[model samples]
Target: MNRSDATLFSGGHKGAEAEFGKLAEKFGINEVNFTFEGHDIERKVGLKILSPDELKKGDVSMDIVSARMGRNFSKVDTIRKVIQSIFHMVNSGYQVFVVGWILPDNTVKGGTGWGVELARLFNRPVFVYEQDRKAWFSWIDNTWVEVTPIISHKTFAGTGTRNLSEDAKNALEALFERSFSES
Candidate 1:
């Protein structure tokens, strides 16, 4: 598979997002990190700070979001920008990959979960490296199925939890290697 033209759209925050940006740099793939002012993110290589107007394009009712995810957001106002930024990332990428825990309730944990939901709503291919399970799972037929995912799409999104585990870090590295390593 050719990775020369691969582009990763990410939030570029700490943990998995930062790791993804680093790996994209290592493999010479283009990366775009969507962020807004006052948002603290670790990766700055491809920062695209969205203006207030741009952010408004991605906005939706927090009540609707909570209804879709089957849960309420603690601080609706503060997390609004993050949801908007994620909208840009997922909207740009045809595929979504993440590193986080999958709860028994079937929803992925934290803010990253919103991305997964958006990807599903968009009908884009979504994969998550379940931290506790230590395996990759793809959203298929409304279920999480174990699979070994590679970067097949020219454009993809990488994101996940801030509390990344060592195993999850290695999994992300392996994913890049498997996708970009020369035959």
Candidate 2:
């Protein structure tokens, strides 16, 4: 696929990043972006952690409310950065993939819910790996629908190599194939 068919893997820091990184590499996708915090901001095997400065450099197209708040940054800065980064990636023509743990409240952890919401809002295809449930879900009909059987969740701690179920891999691969072919 051409560079225009690059993919963006969005998730919070920790195990999700590692999982997404491995999946991107496994699929031979060279361009992927996501958000990271603290010491988890290092470069991964196949993904780039978008920095706050990078977000400021892009055409964010949002009114940053804290622009006049001096250098006293807050969660607003992080929120703006995340939103702008996702917007920039999509605007630059990247297909978005999401992976994260779903809370008991059914919300995604690590701020990944925003990515999923953005994908839905923009009518883009999204493949979500519900880590907590060990299920593969596809964004369809404006909702997440399980596309595969539930599997056992790995009990690994922190960010380490985690394997996605074969069904999840296949579904993601099919999504990528369909996206690249359309591009």
> For candidate 2, what's the RMSD?
9.3
Q: Which stretches of candidate 1 lie over 4 Å from their true place?
A: none
lDDT of 1 at 171: 94
lDDT tens digits by residue: candidate 2, 56-105: 65433333323322122246655567556555444443344555655454
Q: Write the per-residue lDDT of candidate 1 for residues 101-179, one digit (tens) a residue.
A: 8877788888889999999999999999999899999999989999999999899999999999999989999999999
lDDT of each: 0.92, 0.47
| Leading candidate by TM-score | 1
All-Cα superposition RMSD per candidate: 1.1, 9.3
Candidate 1 has an lDDT of 0.92
Index of the highest-lDDT prediction: 1
- TM-scores, all candidates, are 0.96, 0.52
lDDT of 2 at 13: 43
Q: How close is candidate 2 to the true structure, as a TM-score?
A: 0.52
